[model samples]
Target: MKLRELRIEKGITHKQLSDDIGVPVRTISRWEKGESDMLLKNAIKLAEYFEVTLDEFINF
Candidate 1:
C-alpha cells in the first residue's frame, strides 16, 4: 500500500505518523505525494510501526 493508504488504514494522521517515525509531517506529506523517497532506516521504522512488512510498503 501507499504511504497515505497505510496511514489511513492505521488511523494515523500525518503528524502522528511523523512523531512515531521521528520525521516531520512535511516529510510524510512528501512521502504521500511521491515527491520523496523512503530511506532504508525510515522505511524499516514505518513498516515496524505499521506492523507491516517492508515488501508491503515497497510493493505498493
Candidate 2:
C-alpha cells in the first residue's frame, strides 16, 4: 500500500507517524507525496511500527 493509505488505515496522523518513526513531519509528507524516497532504515522503522513486512509495506 502507499504510505498515505497505510497511515490512514492505521489511523495515524503525519505527526504521530513522524514521531514514532523519528523523522520530521515534512519527511513523512514528502514520502506520501512521492517527492522523496524513504531510506532503508526509515522503511524498516515504518514496517515495524505498522506491523508489516518490508515487502508488504512497500507493496512489492
Candidate 3:
C-alpha cells in the first residue's frame, strides 16, 4: 500500500508516527515515495501502533 493511505488512515503525521516508532521522518518519506521497502520490524511496529495487521497496512 501507499504511505499516504496508511498515514491518513492512521490519523498521524509522518514525523509524529516515525518519532513514536523510533524511525526517521525521512525514511517514512522514502517509503511514501517508493524509495524504500518497509522492514519487518518497522511493519510490525506500525501495525501495533495503528492497530492493524500487516495485510491491512499493505492494503491487501
Write down the RMSD of all candidates, one decimal each. 1.0, 1.2, 1.5
Best candidate according to lDDT: 2
Q: Specify the highest-TM-score model's number.
A: 2
Rank order (by lDDT, best first): 2, 1, 3
Q: Which ranking of candidates, highest TM-score first?
A: 2, 1, 3
Q: How close is candidate 3 to the true structure, as a TM-score?
A: 0.81
Could you give candidate 2's per-residue lDDT for residues 23-58 as a string of tens digits?
A: 999999999899998889888888888889999998
Model 3 agreement with the true structure over 1-60: per-residue lDDT tens digits: 666786887688988988898999999889889899988888878777777788887783
Collision pairs in model 3: none
* Overall lDDT per candidate, in order of appearance: 0.86, 0.88, 0.82
TM-score of 1: 0.91
lDDT-better candidate, 1 vs 2: 2
Residue-level lDDT tens digits of model 1 in 1-60 = 488898898898998888877899999999889899878989889888888899987876
